[model samples]
Target chain A: MRCAEHCEVVANRPVATNQFEIEIHCPTVALHAQPGQFVQMRVQSGYEPLFSRPFSVFRRFPERGNFSVVYLVRGAFTQMLARKKPGESVFVVGPLGNRFLVAQPANQVLHLLVAGGVGAPPLYLLAEELVQTGVPRQKIVVVNGARRQDLLVCQEHFAELGVRLRTVTEDGSAGAKGKVTDALKALHGRGELSGNRCQVYTCGPTAMLEAVAKFAQKHDLPCQVSVETLMPCGLGVCLGCAVKVRTANGTDYKRACVDGPIFDATEVVWE
Target chain B: MSEVKLSVKLGPLRLQNPVLVASGTFGYGSEYADLIDLNRLGGIMVKGTTLHPRAGNPMPRMVETAAGCLNSIGLQNVGVEAFIREKLPFLRQYRCAVIVNIAGDSYEEFEQLAERLDGVEGVHALEMNISCPNQEKGGIHFGVDPEATREVVSRVRKRTRLPLIVKLSPNVTDITMTAQAAVDGGADILSLVNTFVGTAIDAKTRRFKLANITGGLSGPAIKPLALYMVWRVARAVKVPIIGMGGIMNATDAVEFLLAGASAVAVGTANYVNPHASMEILEGIEQYLREQGEKDVKHIVGTVKRCKPGNEF
Candidate 1:
């Protein structure tokens, strides 16, 4: 749907520096979304910076026709988006990217979670779903990293869910002082995410995703990663989102907008 | 609820909406079938292709900026043959107009591409991407230098009966001259204001953000510039103009039309909202209703622009 400059922002706030965790009332998308879906939003106005920025559905509030995404104030578009107050309306194109795997009754008893900065959004919702699906609250260990202490937001919600929240700060202000790599390495050594036949779920920056992919593969754990890409047509008309995949389908192409924002780590060329 | 008809005509092509996908962004029309409704568009313009295959520029080719984006993709494509055989079939399934955007390094290549596409099924029109004016034999906005622009436009104009649309480069000092030259050379239509030359630096790394030292800047930053060109070209040439650059909303499209374009295309917005084109069309109809107008064509070039609006 072409988002008319008319949808009221249901929730808008500063979750971090230039980063916001906001929600708008979009029943159509809420009703249509599957876990791991996304929405395309024009970060700003006019023709100069024309394209809309795509964000994953951090948390979909279907009954309320609202959803939220945590984003950094990276640029003018996002900065403009972060500045939007509740009740303001803007055009939004909708739950576009392929979603994450829904809660399935697989044999793996635990979910090893990894996130960085705003990457915490998707994992947060995934954890909520897992809790609802009878996965013990204690079974999910979330490893999150941020450059500084001020960048972390929404900690209380994850804590309230009884998840084991582990923090990695570039500086020693938070939990462990090193980085997420340090946290994962610690977990790997303790068998928390090791030879227990765990399923790993992750979404973060390219470097972090690459690191997680290597760690999961090295340990032979089943891993899936969410890929962030520049997509204009979430429906796959714009080949801007084409990413190389290691698949029999074809050697050269997979539209991240449609084929996936989430994919098996081994199937992707994690460059 | 009123059923607003979003369809409009751009020379020989008929679009379900006025929002056509800009060139160099949407590839060969078949790539995005899964995430979008292909048949529900004004038209789709594939990447710039030439006589031979092009791998395009190197990695780090695209960099995301504040309100817009910078890219030096350099027109990567698999040449016209692969596009015709592999892509068109899947694209044919869509009911919308399919406009082939052609680019070349030489007159021979442009003519070669044009001749081959003359009768391709589902190929409704040809968009001559005269963007890289200097790298090729002619120069960027081939139409910028009227003689060369006319030469290329005339050559391709003669090779195909499909409507010839020359896409103009905005890096020029005067766009209307180029717009007029394309028409003078028998261009059936004109798509104005390709990306403007721009740059972004990584202050910490002390390096350019894009692989290519300089990239084309697109989005809201270029809308006023594009609208100016459309206004100038609208009054200068009789051929229909498909204006683009930084159009993000229906108001933006309507503004471009009032500046004298027959239709408007969404370029960089594709990066933000996958359905921007469809969204703009919806916004345009919403505008027409708010304005109490029954049709949209009446607003073409209806707004009087500040004369300097076309200047760089």
Candidate 2:
């Protein structure tokens, strides 16, 4: 069973504008977590903020029993987390959601890693796993997008891992000027979008997920998109984080905390 | 030093202590089972159950407010029978009392559901929730009307021997009238107040935050309002009360007890901290010990009312 525990912060520092990397030393959570799972963390000690915020696992160092989260300053909780100093206690509950489903026989499949905003963490973590597991670095293509250049984080992290990186920004301040879907569109136009058994994996805001889902549908390709929602418990109990997805019987609301932060792009209702 | 007795009684039911995880927030007692010691709690009130399974509301079911939250879960559950078959067995192993919160669309359904769980072995009590809209009454809720509330409580009272707790909704004109009606209909206990009816809109998008348009307000924001209602009902009714609304810590639970709640249930706090009840339970013990009290029962209805300023 996954446990909710308090982990000591080793570092909580800004890596980019309005973005911070928080490293916590939690042995149990780090040892159990797989790519795509997340942790629900309490920002303050009391009821002022009143809910534990959920952040996807950025990176896990199993040998040292530590995990990192890349977060943007979006609300009070994130703002509190950003100001946290090393050695302070941060309560966390984790390996909470279902892990990213990487299809077996990784050697033959082309892994398409897509990210938006701070959503790059989990996808980048997945890329690292793919490389370590013997999937060729050339088989992985990492595409990231944001509103501007300063907001785009983790580009160099992917490069450091020797994975191919592509970037896009809505304000024309970075690589190809557009959304991540625009980069994918450009790839499709150049006939570099298909062949060799490709699959798409993405995580971001709802608008970006919808566009990625639509693009995958247009190409008739298999895709999995990680989703985000307001979750107080980060457990299936609250029934708070409901995502509507198409089932064989029609559509049903699934809890993002337990059922998935990752789901098939085709099954999502996207509204 | 002697042991401080934490046990509490509600009609024929007895709890290990006065702290319980509230309905809908605890989710069948299995979700937080690993995080906290369930046996330490006084009881576990599972999610709101119905005669049939409910699919619940649309997306954006919950949103956080300043120090509280709004939720329109629409009484989501896998129905009572499925709960018995799938969930009760797991909960039966725990030493804590397991109270099931039941909702219905009509009085008949309420009685029928009561009869179904009449002699169920593992279940300890039934909490009747009349806050849900009554389909038979053209969408008027049962808890809002005194007559409807009395009829449903009386009917269910006759169908089962289990201790009946009528959970009153605060979205009413006079909560005491509903409390009186529930007692008159033979309720053994009164659990108040359920979430207050509330809503929020996204000003920028010109859209409702919740797909349901309106949701029930919970957490610390509703505590003062809920405490007042509990006090009002305690003055009017003879039955025991399980007070809850925005109770985040032991101090809040103590406030409910001082307002005449025989027991307190931690609701929104469970979302904030999975092990909230344990901390609150310990806190209550600490308060009692510090106050030189030998029992938690000493704090019940102990609020001191101030005299008029002119008289003073």
Candidate 3:
């Protein structure tokens, strides 16, 4: 059951350049929140920035009764959120959208988790869960990418999870100075991944997701992507966050808030 | 203080209260059941339904502006058959009135929709959506012209015995023309000021923000205009009015009642706060009690206006 709770800020501070992670103490949300699910936060009490902002659960500490979201200060809402102090109240509605597909299929021998910039939060949670579920640390690989070194977030978190970590950046400021797909190509060339033996999970900007989807298609691997859009009501009533996907017939729009924020790569119709 | 009356009557339809969830904002009512009580509402106007299922428009469908948002959802919904089969049962379990908002590309389709839902078990009323600005055809085309509005209303009226509400478009030269026309064509009530046709542009990208190029605007940005239209339509027509557009709180709702609306529907605010409708409903009762009024009807159309030639 989804609910609206006025959560107390536990910690809200800068995690990296232009990126801040805010933790809120909401037991219901933390206890029920799954990886890739998100919470809609009402940043202020006024109407100037009317709609609540949707943020993916970066980390959920169920025992501590808290969850955190990683956000980039792009506009007024995030800017305001960045200035919030611990103990201040933030109205949140959550445990929303679908969770990442963690149940590995029999043929899938390798799990490749990809992240681009702020998109790393949900994928980080997925990596943590996979490791907890007894998936061999060697079988899981993470590709963290961003525009530059400072923008490449969550690399250390993945490293702490005892998984193989790879870093990519647009400029030569990180591990591999290329896009995430380029790193995937290098991995494939080295036979680290084989056809139909790998399962890919990615979250990032649309351009990056499209490229990853194409890579998975070419490699005959099942891939899942976490998409982002302007979601007014995370409850699916607003129907504003539309993601075009392939249907049995031509094409149709699916509500990213309900049908999924997580979607099978092959089913998404990239424009 | 005496008990305050929240119930209201709109022609043949009687509501438990005057706070309804506007069409399209509250999806089949079940979507919000966990966050708020569905039985506490005056009515639930589900998403705009067409004779056949609609896929709606392409992305991006919605964009936020100053104190408001613009959307071109194009009335995407399961066809009426699926609505009756899959959606209606969930609503039937609740005590709140079920007001189905129906849109069509032609008068024959409107008539068919009305006839199909006329005696349906859970349906309490029908809101003829001749005013949806997001659709490519049918909707606002018939709504902007007075003659077409009257013709469509009467055609649907002829087919259904349920209370009929003609929702008016605000993009016309004069909204009262269509309002009076709807009343003249046997409409039982009127829901004034559907979303105003508007658009937003991204200066950085030099592109329209919405894929539809233009979409209907809703929220507090349009509240004053919606109130003015409701006031105008109230004097022009005798039927009750369900005023909407940018009503975010109890104060906004009361202003509509003072402006001659018998009831008010909460729209865009529902997205901002799922508990908004309940909060507004509680606030309305508090307002009535503070005013020393035992009945809400005492405040309907009670705004004080200066006499002609005596204006300051």
List model 3 lDDT by residue over A1-271, tens digit each: 5679788999998878898889999998889988899899997889979999988898989899999999989899998899899989999999899988874452246889999998999999888888887788888899999989988888778889988999999997989899999999999999888753688899999999999999999988789999979899988887899898899988888999988999999999999
Q: Mind giving the per-residue lDDT tens digits that candidate 1 earns over A1-271?
A: 3232346788788765556787888876766665567777764555435566677777778788777777777776787887788877766666666666743453246787788777777788888878777787677888878878777655656777898899888897777897787898898888776556578788878798888889889888778888877765565554556666775754545667778889889988866
Give model 3's share of reference contacts: 0.82
Clashing pairs in 3: none
The models' CA-based lDDT, in order, is 0.75, 0.88, 0.91
The candidate that achieves the highest DockQ relative to the unseen native structure:
3
How accurate locally is residue A96 in candidate 1, as Cα lDDT from 0 to 100? Answer: 64
Expressed between 0 and 1, the share of native interface contacts present in candidate 1 is 0.37
Better of 2 and 3 by lDDT: 3
Ranking by TM-score: 3, 2, 1
DockQ each: 0.25, 0.74, 0.82
Model 2 spans > 4 angstroms off = B133-138, B306-312
lDDT of 2: 0.88
Badly placed stretches (over 4 Å) of model 3 are A105-108, B138-140, B306-312
**Residue pair clashes in candidate 2:** B219-B246
**Per-residue error (Å), model 1, residue B204:** 4.1
Interface RMSD of 2: 1.2
Whichever of 2 and 3 has more TM-score, that candidate is 3
